[model samples]
Target: MESMKNRESKTAGSLIDDPVILRLFERMPHSVQESFTEEQLMHLKVAVGSRGWGEHAVDVRGSFRGWRHRYYYVMLFGRNRRHLTPGQKRIHNLISAAMLTGFVCVGLLIGLLGLYLLKSAAGIDLFPDHSLGIWDWFNSN
Candidate 1:
């Protein structure tokens, strides 16, 4: 009987060691927790499983009071680690492509503008008869 009790205690100990089960146990009132049987604890462990909420690179939480009201906020930022559906994957790809295109276009525009300014400063013009008025505006400013 003593050995059987030891075995039961060991099983319960192992279940309680699981982080998810331990968290759940911690949340339960002490009186309620003391009343739980090993079998019930095992059931809780099985039901909760071992998965955890994903970690975040940045996690911020705060509370503030304004106008006699209290408000809370959470901000989490991280690389996505979840599985994506095919349509969702396609949308992600499209967004990524569009961002890349926009970035490249902006970079090229800045490079061309810099080159044009340099050429104007050096008194070099490909078309002497026409003006974009940028150099004149730059000089006036």
Candidate 2:
């Protein structure tokens, strides 16, 4: 009866309650986690808990809810990316530069178009102005 009662009672601050420790456990490779000792787990819990979660932590946690396993797997093993060959690297750089240039050109064109539209017709407005505009068409009032 004494042993049964002792086993049933849990001390406060269990690893199961800590989100950071749980996350670290999940992020660790299966073999690594399996070999980890209770003391090591406790140390990890304290270390992770001491590092305060930042402003973006909530946003990250929200997104991770559904994809936690996938995210953990990728984080643990996806960093070993294949090196690009010299030609492939050159082509990648060229493509990146071209994309950046295209983006800048598109932005400039849009700005110029906006300026032209604003300056061309004084009566023309992007937003609904008076009774004859889009508001009246939708509201009929």
Candidate 3:
């Protein structure tokens, strides 16, 4: 009996209710939400205006008499931002970043091209009896 009762009790400050912010927080990349107080999580349900145009009619044209379920939509107002390290900031601009990436890709391509050309031009077939064109003329003689 005591164990059952203890499970139901929760801490006062802990956020037990899942709000919109809570769901969004899980998906934010490179971000951490500062702890929010429990009171801040309390949301009031708003009532929508009656559809009957303020007249209680025998034949109801359109009106909802039952309670409408609503929840406060909490938008994660601001992104969690960080001041970039000096080195990171130095390379942060789009042009700089794109240029760096482009340079790296270009370098890789150039290296591969050079290796292909080297193998193509060198004609030193590591495997015997493999014929590489043009350069084969040099060694065949």
Best by TM-score: 1
Q: lDDT tens digits, residues 102-133, model 1?
A: 99999999999999999999999899799899
> Mind sharing the TM-score for model 1?
0.52
- Candidate 1 — which residues are off by over 4 angstroms? 1-54, 60-75
Clashes of 3: 0
lDDT of 3 by residue, 13-90 (tens): 444334544554455552234333334433311121222323332323333344675434322333325577878777
Q: What are the per-residue Cα lDDT tens digits for candidate 2 across 1-141?
A: 223233225466545446766688677775565565556667877776774333231232222445446332221222324588999999989999999999999999989766655544455555454333333343464
Compute the lDDT for candidate 3: 0.49
Best by lDDT: 1
Q: Clash totals for all models, in order? A: 0, 0, 0
Please tell me which model should have the higher TM-score, number 1 or number 3: 1
lDDT of each: 0.78, 0.58, 0.49
Residue range with the least summed lDDT across 10 consecutive positions in model 1? 1-10
**Residue 34 in candidate 3, Cα distance off native in Å:** 66
